[model samples]
Every structure is written in C-alpha cells, then in structure tokens.
Target: MKKLVSLLLVLLVFTGTASAADLSPDVRSAILVDAASGKILYQENIDTPMPPASMTKMMTEYLVLEAIKDKTITWDDIVTTSDYGFFLGRYGGSRVFLNEKERRTVRELYEAMAIYSANDATAMLAEHIASTETAFVELMNEKGQELGMKDSNFITSTGLPRNILSDYAPPISLGEQVMSARDAAILARELINTFPEALKIASTPKAVFRQGEDDQVEMINWNWMLPGLWYELEGVDGLKTGYTEAAGNCFTGTAKRGNIRLISVVMGAKSKEHRFKATKELLEYGFEAFTVEKIAKKGDTIKGYEKTKVLKGKKLEVPVEVAEDISLMVKRDSKIEKVVSLTTVEAPVKKGQVIGSVAFDSESDYLREKDKQDTEINMVAVEEIEKASLIIRLFRGIKNFFLGLF
Candidate 1:
C-alpha cells in the first residue's frame, strides 16, 4: 500500500503539472507569510472568503491603539460600560463581567479585548471610541477598507453577535466582518508591523483587567499557542483565536525568530491540535526554505548616473546610488520574476531618494489577482551635507518658535 501510494503521488504530480498548485488537505484555508513585508510565501484556499471568528479582534484592537496614539483617547481614561457593554455580556457574549457605569481604564480594556478576547470589553471599547456600537462598527469597516480588507464588514465589535432573534440563529455567524484567510493574514501583518509596541502588551500570559477600588476580573489569554506551547518557539506573541459554529477553530499567529517575523493564518481547522500542528509545519517550512538577500544598499547612487541635482538645496549635485539594495529569497534555485521601477523616481534629488520600486514574483495567486497589493517599504532620507545659509538658519529658528506656540 505504501509503494502504491508513492507511485500514485508521482502520477498525480505529472497529471497536474500545468496547474502547478499545491494545497494541504488538513486545513480548510491557510496562508504563511513574512510579517515585515506582508508577502505570502505559501497559501491554500486563502482567498475563499470565510468567517474570521475572533480573529476579528485584531482590527478592533488596532483601532483602539490608533485612538490612543492620536491622543483622541488615553490609556488611563475611564471606559464606562453602558447598555451596550452589559448587554453583550448577558447575551452569551464573553465578558470581564463589567456592569453598566462600572469603568475600566483604556489600558485594562485593551488587555481584556486583545489578550483575553472579552466580548463585553471589546464592545465597550467600540462604544468608547465612537459613542455607539453602530458607529464603532462603521469605523471598523471604514478602517477595514483603508487597510485593504476588501472582503470584510463589521456589524458588531465582537464576533458573537446573534441574528437568532430574527429566526436566522445561524451557528455562530463567523464575523459580521467577513474575510478571506489571505486578507486576514494581511490585516494581522499590519497590526504587528504598524504598532510593534503592541507586542509588549500582547504577549502577556495573564492580565488584571478590572482593577479598581471595587470589584475586579482576571483574564488569562486564550491564545495558548504562544506562551503555553513547548517547542523551539520564542518571540511567538499575540494575535487572536476565534470559533463559532460557522467558523471552526481559527487563529492569527505572529512570531519573531531573531530579525525575521512570520505570521500564519488558519481558518476552518478541524480541531485545536490541527491549528497548532499546521502552524508549526508552515513556519518551520518558511524558516528553512528561504533567506533574505540584500541586492543593494540604501542611498546607493544610480550606478550609471554619477550625480543628480538637488532641488532648492545649496548643493548643485549629489552622488546617487540604488536607493536600497532590493533583496528577497527564492526557493534555493527557483527563478523569480524581478521588476524594478527605478525610472519613476526623478529626484531633483536626495541621497535617499525613492528612485523606483522592485518587485519579484515567485508565483501567481489563483485567487482574485485584481486586488492583490504589494508591500514595498521605503528607505530613510539621506542627508545633503551642504550647509544652509546663515539667513536660512535664522529663519528656521523663527519658524520653529512660532510653530511650537499654540
């Protein structure tokens, strides 16, 4: 039987050589990605949109972070749990047991939502940001569109909203915010990439969410794959876990091994073990199968052009180099489709000019190719050494003082 199976596998490969697609039977949908670049190294059914379960929390949590960063809110500010927060807890939604008028700080609420996946806390947070649950949902979807989550829409802050009262009591209607595994992966990547500071808070094993002069709650994070797992795992931090009848076990996992960070998304998994095993397999494959190659250095002048003009600067010309060393790993010997758009950057110019962009396509995605976007991070600006005029320096000081004044 073993020999026959091996022969059958070989025949199947030859039979479908033209299609040249690989998929694992274990997971219903999945994607393995590079966290820094948002590149999909491997995917299976990633674009077949599905209910994202609690993975929806990633978006909700980030919006809260954004609120805090913008000073529209503060972590120490009290979050009053109103009808919305209490209603969610009473109706089978997860909660930190926060009651109406009871308040938790923004920091504590963040821990409750991101670390413990608390439904009441998440709902209350949504209410805090936009003043109403409906408003928060709109904000969630708006941010979703901005982040390229084309398949998602948020009807509730928590993934547990029920339509059963209307007779459509579908077994856990995934997320009102629907998303494909691939888009889900992209969203997860943005959270970690944009707010790396969130990690220090995300990896906590236990959190005291309802601390105050009265009543309290303790939340042990549900993402067991991080601190609880025993493997060569390290730098494996947050994300979220979700489940509803419609959406099976789901997870968005992020980890950093040295300088490299990887994210894995799995939806519709059979069991808890299936998610852990599949994630481990995909990450291990990525770690061993690829490497980063730096093809150019930042501020590298164009090889052929000796110098370029600097606009409005004291210097007439500055040496130009490849803005950055474009580096990406290919399968040990896999040929990559390399295209560099160096022509678009016509800098009058700067040392660190984005003369153009480089993209290497290793393969094509079968899913909607129309929407796939590239993640090309820009390099820092290189300084022009020429000094500013004395008059320019004096004027700069005057401008700084006036700008600093309210």
Candidate 2:
C-alpha cells in the first residue's frame, strides 16, 4: 500500500497541475493562444461564425499598415473626408468628426481609428488606401483571404450599419459581419507578428491630434490594459477593442515578456465587465499554466541546419535558424517535441525569410543542453557565418569529422 501510494503521488506530480478550467461563462465565444507558436492554447466555440462588430477593426488596422508598408500611403499623407466619413461622424459614430472638405494626415487617421475607435478616421484612412471606403473594404477582405481569415468579411471601414443592395430588392443593412474567434485571433496574431513597430503607438495611454479645424482632440486610448487601468503585467502593448450590439464587447490583446509575445482574443462577453474579466483570465491562464523555457541563446549553432545545402541562390548554404527566440510554454516537467523545417526559397537560403515553422508538439523543450535549462532559442543569421574563412570551415569540419568517427 505504501509503494502504491508513492507511485500514485509520483504520477500526479509528473503530470503537472491541471490547467485552469475554461473559466469564461459569459461569452458566446473565446480563444487564448500562444502568439509565437500560433497554437490554440484554450478555446471554446472558436470556429463558430459570429458577427464581429468592432473586432473587425483589427483587420482594418492591419490593412492600413499594409498600405503604409507598400508605400501606397505615408503617415503624413492627407486624406480628405468623404460623404461617408461625414455621415458617420454626423450620425454620432465614434469619430474625429473631420468635415467633408477637411483633411487629416494618415497618422492622425490611423491613431483615431486605432486608439479612439473613430469611424470617421477609419473611413478617411480607408480612402487614402483604396480611394474609397468600399474599395478599402475589398482590400481588407483580400488581405483577410491572404491571412486565411476564412470566416470574415469587411462590409465597411467603420463597421457601421450600411445598407447593401444584394441580389434581392432594396439595399439592406448588413445583417452580420461574420468572423470566428479563432480567425480573429489569427488576424490579430499576424498584425503583431508582421508589424511589431505598431506596438509603440497602440500601447500608448493617450494620443493628441489636431483635426482639420485645428481642434486638438484628446484621444484617450480605448484599450483598458494600459498603465492606469491594468494589472501588473509587463510588455503589454496596443491592440484593438471591438463591440457592437450584435457582437457584444471583444478585445484582442498582445503582450511581450522578455522576447516571447502572445495574443489573446475574447469575444461575445455580455458586458464590459465580462470582457475585461475574461481577457484577464485568458492572459493569466496562458502565463501561469505554462513555462516559457528558452533553449538556445543567440549565436548558438542550430544542429542539422548547417548540413542542409541550399540548392540555388547568390549565396551558399544559408544558416536556417529559429530567428526569433524559440520558447516552449509547457506543463512543468513535460518535454517539448520540436520539428524544424526550412520554408525558404528553393535555393540559397538568404539571411531572412520564413525558413520554416518549428512545430512544437505538446509543450516540449526548444533545445536541450547540459546543465542549462532549455530557455529560448535565438537564431543566427546566415550572413554572420558567410564571412567565415575556408580554412576555419575546413578545420571545424575536420574536428567534427574526427569527433563523429570516434
């Protein structure tokens, strides 16, 4: 009996504490994810299609950034308000209230949409990209397709009620802007993963901008997770909050600790209280349930990557690395299983360009080394090794050969 009890105790200890339950009782849907791994850590009704109200703003923000990156627009570029922008502002949608003939810089517009959830700013910003809100909504859908937001559609820049003349008769206000919590989380993850620079703006507690009338409007960030109102979490940054009578309140939050960043999305919560509570629960569950163990430090060699030959390119075999810090947040004491693949071009691997995803299964270590606990793996770029002399390479090869032979 004593031995059996000891064995049972050991088994319980090895299994790690049971993860906190899916505590959300209020929301219609929700998802908690590991942003780095794109793994669904916890989910309930994640794939179900539902109306995505203002949560659609995350995609709008993403499209705006894509346009900026493509040089289709600039921060200082001015967008004149349109009839749509005017109507929305006039009708009391959250707005910067730029007049139909008035102009505001793209930076001001982007912030207004992102920080203040301003519909007029969004419409004007969309016009700057696609010359019309309708066209920008198309661009938003196109980009959503590229990002695999399979269940989503953008009917308007402001996510306002717009009557559309469908195959039926008179124009009807869109009954729904469909999206899945998982798809929404995926888009939010892409926005942060692609343009980390936006964090500097999104995380701000407040932003001040002058409208076309030179009115200095104080745009207090609508995100509730900033300094004054947040828990003692570090590296929390800007994402967007969304709400509509149909969608309820939703929030997509992204935070970084050390080098590990994560995105969380909670939707369909009954009230602002549920929204905030559920989000905090997701973040806490993510951070507390698993441990991010760093395995390989920067400048460390990635085994097997050196031996893989690059088929063709201007350079030779490029060093394929886990460019960012590779962390495994696993059940304590559970091993991590990682499979690395090279997703680079068909030939010479360059310094950067998604080589491949390192598939980590069931929370395992990224890299295992003697004495040192597996932390995170920082990648070494190919350019750094490109400069090594032939003699040094040959000598290293000879040493490795001898070690293997022995």
On TM-score, the leading prediction is: 1
Predicted candidate 1 versus true structure: per-residue lDDT over 1-406, tens digit per residue: 0010100111001111111143353778888887755666788877787877788888888898899889999999898888767666666455677777877788877888888888888878888899976677778888888787767766677776466212322234333557788878877877887888777777877777655646667777767767764432566786778887788888888787766778888899897677777777777666666555554456644333444434334553455444545555334434445333333222234446543443445253422333233423343335544555768657767988999995
lDDT of 1 at 166: 29
Error in Å for residue 116 of model 1: 0.6
Please give, for residues 138-191, the per-residue lDDT of candidate 2 as tens digits. Answer: 787788888777777677766654432122111334335678887888887788
Once fitted onto the true fold, the runs of candidate 2 whose alpha carbons sit more than 4 angstroms away are 1-18, 163-175, 211-214, 230-234, 295-326, 333-335, 338-359, 362-406
True lDDT of residue 44, candidate 2: 81
Per-prediction TM-score: 0.73, 0.70
TM-score of 1: 0.73
Q: Which parts of model 1 are misplaced by more than 4 Å? A: 1-25, 164-176, 211-216, 229-232, 298-321, 340-406
lDDT, model 2, position 17: 56
RMSD of 1: 14.2
Give candidate 2's whole-model lDDT. Answer: 0.66
State in Å the error of residue 204, model 1.
1.0
